[model samples]
Target: MTRRALGRRYLSAWIGFSAGGRFSQALATVILMFAFGQPTVQALVGSAGTWAVLVTLVVLGGLSLLGQRYRIEWHGVLPLSLLAFVGYCALSVLWSEYSWVALREFAATLGFIGLGLYLALGRDLVQVIRASGDAFRILLVVALGLEVLSGLVLDVPIPGFGIRGDIAYGGPIQGIGGTRNFMGFVAAMALVTFVVEFLTRSVTAWRAVASTALAVIALMLVQSPITGLAMIALAVTALALWALRHAQPRTRPVVNGVLGVFVMVVAVVAVLAHSRILAEIGAAGGSASRLALWSQLRVLIEQHPVQGWGWVGTWPSEPVVPFDVVLAPSGLPFTSALNAFVDAWLQIGLAGMLILLGTAVLAFARAWVTATTFPGVAYVWPAAVLVLLAVTSTAESYLLHGAGLMVFTAVLVIAARRRSWRGRLPR
Candidate 1:
């Protein structure tokens, strides 16, 4: 074949991959789990291996975008609010205390945004959701397989990774993921995806059941409190959305209004009675620790409330805010504010926090509206996922990195799509 023909073939493959083809989906599954999975693959092959995987995916994604003649449509194809938030993050590099770190994180953020945009623009919502589900299925299987090997056959913790077989106390199984909480988070997401797939009849009943069973089993073994709460929140939100979807059109506005009011009231009450509530839930110690950290973080925020210290993708190795002075006595490994909102404030200041909050509020609102009125079962997944993210973000800084950032981008893309396309979706 001619060089041009070869380029065309390569482009076709990249596009297929972006559209959630089997090969691309498999690669994505690994990429998503790489960092969390104790850096298992990274330990063997070294950082070079991880870099190679990332570079390959990035190149394929870039080729896919070029093949589509993709254009960045900030207002139409993408949400302006999200763009504003990301732009602020990039711009913060100027005022950031750690400019180099900020720059690196900014680049990574852009890369994730690009990947999300490629998936959203190149394929319909159904295809993206299905592709994500497939990726999750693979991750779930791999994680569980590793856990079985570690707990049964090998009968020892994975070498070099420090993954232990804590079969007692519901396991605390790290699986391939580095931390039990991270594994639980992945499993929770997989459970949500599989549930959606089954509800929509997108997969064979047996396959759906098996996938969900694996996810649930993984989640149980990991025993992450945050994921457990998130699972419940997701279930409640999904059921409510289903009910709203079936309600009369005219009643939706009224029902939504009532629900909004109810949620606000509950939020206010929770804030007022937070201490007692935390005590009741047996989370007083954890909540107190978070409060102490928040207090210290607040002092730092006030120092530069408008501009912030800088956006480090992950927590800095060194003390950026005298956290060591305040939190050292507690002996808590408090790397983050334990909340995405607070973390955003600490990293980019109050203005950045508002932008992040605004982006989330608008995206969730749009997703909720579309899911209820879009006339298809598949529309519900984004809304459900958003709810789960929101719940998780309260206690974990899941945003601004890896799977969290991708999900955030996907929601924005789904929310921005034209309503006219709803009719084109499969029933």
Candidate 2:
């Protein structure tokens, strides 16, 4: 093949294997399926595939060096973020209530960070973002479709028919906690992509109808109405601020005013909805069980405030399920849990909180700027992340190793790079 053809083939292959590729999504699907007991070995293979993406990035980085033709524009605070994470992990190992467990968490966290860094910094950011976004759209469609079918058709004697906690969420949709919020989060992001693309691309009647239908369908399926509710507020607020700062003076006030109204409305709705959750929480004496277990976390941090828990092991010890109330009776490691932030802070202390905050500010700030420059790039991932931080803080703890942080980091870095490219290219 000619040099041009070789280069084209290489580009295709790179895009195909990157974070957003079909292979990656397939791996994710397989993992979830395995969690549902599709096959132990198959699940393990899927797990290996996740790692393989990380390995590919390392190998790709080496290849780029050999070709001597690669360039990275913005390093994007990743190294500092990763380094701080390492320090926090070390602290956890030293002070962890569950020392051995914390150690495993530490190792797992390190591996996850390593994988994300390889993809975010080394691979082609644009391709990854586009591919990942596309893959997410596909996943949303497939997941929602499966959810409907399983609910309507496969409900009988179906073993592992719903979310088994394999790949974040799968199988039949559990009520509030059973992948409802999780899939809602994914759909919220998809809505953002749809809107952003609609703004830039041709908004044909069919396209508009399809997007409107999908958005409504996702809202219905997610049932966690607040998820989409949050996105609307964030997008309006983020964009209005951006426009005020960067748009022409004549257009600025108008854009800001319109977005301002949109935001105010969203805020009012969110406040009312949040009040309901808080009311329920208060009436029930708070997410106390989660709070109680989480309170031990505070004790752990206070003991090692600077680096409260030892990083390498799970130091703090408590009964796995102290609470009498049962949420998911069948789910293993069941507890009254809500958010990742609380767990991290409890496990790692103020320092860990700072690290997480710093990571978010740096990553989100970059993404915000990018979104501002190319409004088309503005999407729900950032908004979804904001809600994830809030919701997960209330229920679960998986940001470091789970799909949440990985997808969030991958999208933010790629968005930053794409914004940079748009800046350089001639209009």
Candidate 3:
């Protein structure tokens, strides 16, 4: 064989070996754990560690994509709405008031998106879900362990993991997720994953039960009202999915219509009784802080209503125009608007906000439809996760960055693979 041919053969063999099932699973797990533990990393090793982790994932995922080049059918693989939103975010750099910040954030956004795409395209849906399940279990345990050592054993907050030594107080514990709300969010995702794994018989019954118990404990310890509400939404979605999956095909249409109407009515009722509900649930104080922050954001959003300040994924430490206009509870610049939609408007503008809404809504619709029609339990993962994300996003900007953004992109791709129309055309 020619020298070039010999080199190509060796490279192909290496790719095949590296992208094999076991290696892919490990990659997915590491990526997920790294994404979820961003705050812990930032606390321990600072920005250098964060950048190193990102670079490693980018390199690993990029090579995996190259190795699986032919396996991922590239016909309408990505949803158009998603592309429009991300593209707009990138385009914002041109008119961004802080061009440097915008460029840096745009790069970070692509890095995470690439990691997500690798998981969705390089690994099957079941494999990705399983990896997520495994990663969450490990992280949740670590969170609890750290909390125990900090809150109970040492009687002091662990600065690195952000455990506020509140576990002894029955928590509001941060865990490896960096905050109570984040920890709760991770637990909620873990619960969904565990349920699906059980339904699919992918894990033993005892194992599923144990994982579910761990997630529930973490949720309780975190004491986050945002997660409380999300769990409620998750339960409702689970019930709806179960009903639809069990219903006869002929009657499914009627059932779906009725469920849709029911959901609308419930939403209206919830909005109307929000005040009473908040007071009863002890979320009024948190809600008030959020409202004040949003009011501040609204003023900022008004300045450049057409195309707001710009895209900076995380707020800058130094006081800047929009990013530092408001302060976090810690007296530093607030990182997010605490609501994904409002944050989108603040960073990208009304047009970008609308595209983002379209992307999320379209993704949910596709996932919901697939869950209803597909026989496998795996189809429900995307829909259940989207519901959880939507609910939590009402109070926290979890959907915008870190693990949330990565998972969002992955689910979007998985749902689009089967539901998007562009895939029907010749590639």
Candidate 4:
């Protein structure tokens, strides 16, 4: 073969590897569970896991650069908003109370943003979504295997690692993610992905059925209230999108407007009846601490209302900021504000929060419109994930960190492309 032929073949292989190959899938699993020092992987690999994640991200990013076929496209203000958010985070290092910690965390967040951008720009939205689904499938399988071994074979907690048997939790299973809540989150996402694939006819019927069955079983075993509730919200969103997809184009805007109003009303009512909603979910008592934490965080935000405390990635247990000092007195240690919006305000202040929220609202609106107007299931990917993130952000601080943030960025990229495509097509 000629030299040119060999180069082309090598590029093809590299593209395949980074897109949705086994290595990519496995790497994603590691980043989601172990990269940020989840207990089980940390116990097994020590601090090496974090280094491994950094090295892998660098390698994949390098490969993406070499394998690029087209220039990276920028959609509009949405992408700019995201870049501004990251830039603001980096700038926070200068004013941060703990400059060293802020700098370190900023680097980590930047790495994730880079990884997300690489995936979004290097591949089509369908390919990227499929790649993510592939990763979730493999991760769920591995988690189930570990859960079975711990719960049935060993009947004892794994030494050093935090893998606990079903017997220990009485019923709920943690799986390999090291916590029931994390496992539930993964399982919930898996279910959504499988359903989308099935609807799109991207996967064989049997494969879809089997993967979705596994996800449902894992979700049941994990029994996380937050994940369970999030799934319900996703289901409702999916149904609404489906109806809109089937509706006439002229009627969609009206339908969407009414739905928007209804959702806002429901949200207000839920907030007003927050304690009742918590009681319905059996979390009323546990939420007292979260309410208290929110109250303390509000005071701290007032102190630095414009440009709050610097971004710390994850909140430290030792009380790094003024808010942390107040939290320390409660005798109940707090890591996150347990709310993404609150954490954003606490970390980057009001300006950062507005940028983040504005970006999200715009992205979700574009994705929803595209999904409803477009004919394929591919468009539903972004809409579904955005709904999941929005619902979960209320109780978990996953929206702006680690794997969750990465996925959020990728969805934004996809939404931007959809808008660009629509703009170019003849009316």
Best by lDDT: 3
Encode model 1's per-residue lDDT on 89-155: one tens digit a residue.
8888898766776787687677667667766765567767677777778777777777777777777
Q: How many backbone clashes does candidate 2 have?
A: 43
| Per-candidate local distance difference test | 0.74, 0.49, 0.87, 0.75
Clashes of each: 3, 43, 0, 0
The worst-scoring run of ten residues by lDDT in candidate 3 lies at 313-322
lDDT of 2 by residue, 272-374 (tens): 7865755543423434455555555555456556654444222222342222222332443433235566555655667776787776666665555554444
| TM-scores for all predictions | 0.86, 0.63, 0.96, 0.87
* Local error of candidate 4 at residue 353 (angstroms): 0.8
Stretches of model 3 off by over 4 angstroms after superposition: 1-13, 328-331
Task: Name every residue pair that clashes in candidate 1.
Answer: 36-178, 37-176, 37-177
Model 2 worst lDDT run, 10 consecutive residues: 32-41
Q: Write the per-residue lDDT of candidate 4 for residues 1-427, one digit (tens) a residue.
A: 9999999898889876665545554554444444323445556676567647566775776575454534555434136667788888877788988988788778767777766766676666666656667777877787777767887887877646456777345557776666676677778878888888888787899999999998988888886778877888887898899889889888988889988898899889988998898889777865786787888888889988988799876675455656457544457667677888899999999988998899899889889888999888888988988988887788778787766787788788888776744445454
